[model samples]
Target: MKYINKKIIFTFLLVLLMNGCLGIIPNKDSVTRKDTTTNIESSIYKKYNRHTDTTYYSHNNLFGKNISIYWTKKKKEKSYARIKFSYLGSRWIFFNEVTLVNAAGSRISFHIKSTDISTNVVSDRIVSEKANFLLSKVDIISLKKLFNSPSVDLRLSGKSHKDYALSESEIKSLFEILSYNP
Candidate 1:
């Protein structure tokens, strides 16, 4: 009886070990086929001149206060691009200029100035502008990378300027705008 019981226990342990090993070894045939399908899709998207749409937002801590900025691709032209963006909150009062530029030396810029009431002390103005191809690609991933990259020496009256990462939703909206062929 003892020998029989031992045999049964040993068989159960062997079965359990085999099941565990099977779980760890992935079915290579299925994984390889799935990867092949994804590669083909990616290649197709690239071949068709398909541009993705994206939106990006960023924030900064300036003078102990938070200032938020956003950029979105609004439209595209045969030889140019159009983008819309906003500087949120009270800090908007300080901003004085905004611009967008491309490689062909085309530029579009906007400016504003706040009039001081009491002390007659005007703040160091705020300016926002897009330069280089980076501004043209305003998707979430690219925007995040842009903020992380080196500064482009954008300043307003000696005040340093910087960009921050945008939210996921903002990136999606920007992509939508860019993807519209019209």
Candidate 2:
């Protein structure tokens, strides 16, 4: 009975190893970060699971004084890109829309899915708002077009609006952040 039990345990471990359920082996995905010359910072990293044949992409961007952004997608989720915008402010702005303007004066719009607000009590009271945005395939294509433009500007709107024109360095960082592929 002891010999049979040991054989069963060995078989289970071998099966787990073969199926990558053991989680002991290192993954082969390479993560790359681009050098930024400007105050704006951005990076994209990919994590690939060989056993399940799935790729996960992580994109992070930090803009000016108060806005930070992260975009992510899994390989199987072809139609949607999940993006979160974290804004630090005194009160909720309730951002609902984002517009991208290329150098040619053309504009593309993305509708934000939702916004959530919270307050933090620190040395100074500050309100933090997180806006969730979902980009469809069409929006992604429009973003690609903006990436090729000489300059880009971002306009975010809700109860209030904020506009930012990308500097050369910021534009370069945004380009690099969006260029990553699985």
Candidate 3:
């Protein structure tokens, strides 16, 4: 009887110790990770994914509108900038032309290679449309050169044309986004 009690106690103690060790060890899934990367002076936000080895940079609320600029690059892929313009009207504006005018009055134009359109119906009478344009490598180089200036103006043209003068904040964010080597 004593032997049985001792065996039971010993088993209980062993199990408790094992559980204690498990509780002390941190779990891989439970470990908290920082979602956003460190901030730079330009307020450009970046997020990195360890699994895919990619980095994404984005800036929101550009041009006094809800426009957003995004840049992403994978480990072995070329980086590209995607500019999304939000239009409040219902008409479709398939923007295919992009022009950047620097503060020095020099202009660089780019024919958009990739374009996407998405529309959202807010109400029975109101609809919102978003158009996305991808900038090419040469356009990016021109943007890098124009980054030295104080501001840059952007123009998008399709069936119609719209002009946007980039604010100083927008220019700063673009400078940082274009300044990266990779």
After superposing candidate 3 on the true structure, give the runs of residues whose Cα lies further than 4 Å from its correct spot: 1-42, 48-53, 60-68, 75-86, 113-137
Give the TM-score (vs. native) of candidate 1. 0.24
Score candidate 3 by lDDT: 0.59
Residue pairs in candidate 2 whose N, alpha carbon or C atoms collide under 3 angstroms? none
Error of 1 at 116 (Å): 21
- Candidate 3, position 65, lDDT: 46
What TM-score do all the candidates reach, one by one? 0.24, 0.53, 0.55
Positional deviation of 13 in candidate 2, in angstroms?
50
Ten consecutive residues with minimal summed lDDT in candidate 3? Answer: 27-36
Against the reference, the lDDT scores of all candidates come to 0.30, 0.52, 0.59
Per-residue lDDT of model 3, residues 34-151, tens digit only: 2123344234467898898889877432332434567888978988787666555435455667677888998877565443566677444444556676777776677667856777
Error of 1 at 175 (Å): 1.9
In what order do the candidates fall by TM-score, top score first? 3, 2, 1
Q: Mind giving the per-residue lDDT tens digits that candidate 1 earns over 1-182?
A: 99978876665554444223222332223212113233222211111223644433221111111112333332352322333333322132343544433223333343433441111222233222222222344443343333332221122221333333333322222333233322
Q: RMSD to native for every prediction?
A: 21.6, 16.2, 19.6
Candidate 1 or 2, higher lDDT?
2
Candidates 1 and 2 compared by TM-score, better number: 2
| Candidate of highest lDDT | 3
- Give, for candidate 1, the lowest lDDT window spanning 10 residues: 58-67
